[model samples]
Target: MLELEKVTAAYSGSKVLFGVDITANKGEITCLVGRNGVGKSTTMKAIMGLVSTPSGDIKLDGKSIFTLPTYSRAKAGIGYVPQGREIFPQLTVKENILLGMEANPGVKEIPQEIFETFPILKEFLERRGGDLSGGQQQQLAIARAVVSKPKVLILDEPTEGIQPSVIQEIGRVITRLKKDMAILMVEQYLEFVLEVSDRCYVMEKGRISMSGRTDELDKDRLQQLLSM
Candidate 1:
């Protein structure tokens, strides 16, 4: 339900993304895979309207949202768990999650199902967000996003610095999310991305160089492009 059409973005006058195009459909997972500094994250930032761009069209459910502010984008059903799982350090687990509700308009109550996807959060409802382990914080980040009940979810490297078991848990949660939300991610874990995503886009030098159905991807070609 999200489309990035020939997007080009930059800092000051220097551009990074050049005609970058990617799409994520409802109840599907679309992944962006690339080595470091290839503009994968930049693409997401553009979609989120975190950076002003010279040209592009970013649409959510067929509505033009490119010129909107980041807050407006979040209100329009985009939930983003950025790289590093930027949870509020001092806020109690319950309080941290409540912040997500700001994105909601008429919603009056928290979803009990938020705890269903993340039972760990229920037990530590009063704990400080910074006091939790990395995995717990990541889970909290995802749970916080879920509290908003977004139509599209964008996770930036959810597995970057966590234990294997938590990574597995995150994988399971994402699997379940794909049953409803349009999920998109920029991840370094190729196997994880392939296992969870329906389609993959490989970026190189700030552009999509290869992409296809995850199961049919050419491993060698992807490996070569990733090494560049």
Candidate 2:
């Protein structure tokens, strides 16, 4: 499980997140939804220690990770698939995934479940990451993250530019992964979020404005918030 309590973050002393609080429990998907520039991505970065959070705490399980470095956070069971996919362009698919094992030095081999979750990656193991399509690259990113068998998985805009079919596949993979780890994501695609998420947190202007069970939230209000 992951919990962000009264987390406030900033860039160059300009505050972004304002006392944000969220919880993602094991075996469930918790989504953060909001329009651009609402600090959604900043929240993820703050959790990962990629940005400075001068106040509040980010806890995995029950201990605070706010003071840990980025790599230390990864080692502590937080897997992050950043918004751009950010795969190493020159590395082969196999090599890229193998790099993920750095988070867990004791784990020498890529997990078998990774291939099962992404069969296409198996066939393209030797192919350069840059050569793969957008969807394949996104899949590769997720594969790289989950290969570490993290306790908490964080995805930023998983469906940003992928085709619809791949989006569905990613959704299914996300849903399945929840049974093994706490899943948290920042997404704007409401349809995909509604279909796969167990809970939703609607953020506005760097703060959580509303939150509730996905199905229990007022759909029209949710839609209206996203539109604005």
Candidate 3:
């Protein structure tokens, strides 16, 4: 499990997350929902150690990792797909995915699992990342992240601004990914979050205002806070 205990993070002394606590269990999907800038992305950053949370402890499977740098944290089994799909625009899809394994040389050859899950990527192995549609680029970004097979996978708004059909395909892929990895997703799409997540956290102003299993949250409460 990936756990953050009373984590607090800041950018140049300006606070974003205030004593945030969250857990993403192995083989489960944990969803975080909030309006833009309520610290959903900040929470993801804290967990990934992209931003320092000096005051709180971050643990992976019960050991502390608060001191680890971002890349080192990836070495210890964490992968992040940032808000924008940060694939190399000039590189072919196959090359972009291959870069994910730079740290582990013995781990070679793009796994068949990744290609099967995102078959379109296989078809476009020779295409440049910038040439694909936004949704297709998003898929490539995810495929690249999984090449090293990290235990914890994070995605920040994977479906933002995509067409409905592509969104559904992405959702299905997320479901399949959970079978082998822990997932923490931050999204604005309410119905999609409810459909696939095992549990949800409602964030307002950097704190979890309410959280529970997807089935336990009331419609009225979710609508009111999300509309704020």
| Top-lDDT candidate index | 2
Identify the leading candidate in terms of TM-score.
2
Give lDDT tens digits, candidate 2, residues 57-133: 99999988889999999999999999999999999999999998889887888888788889999999999999999
- Displacement of residue 176 (Cα, Å) in model 3 is 1.4
Off by over 4 Å in 1: none
**Tens-digit lDDT track of model 1 for 46-136:** 8888876789799999999988889999999999998999999999999988998888875567789888888999999999999999999
Model 2, runs deviating above 4 Å: none
Error of 2 at 152 (Å): 0.4
Worst 10 residues of 3 by lDDT: 100-109
Ranking by lDDT: 2, 1, 3
Q: Which ten-residue region of model 2 has the weakest summed lDDT? A: 106-115
Ranking by TM-score: 2, 1, 3
Pick by TM-score: 2 or 3, better one: 2
Report lDDT (CA) for all predictions.
0.89, 0.95, 0.87
lDDT of 1 at 96: 89
TM-scores for all candidates? 0.97, 0.98, 0.96
For model 3, the local distance difference test gives: 0.87
Error of 2 at 160 (Å): 0.5
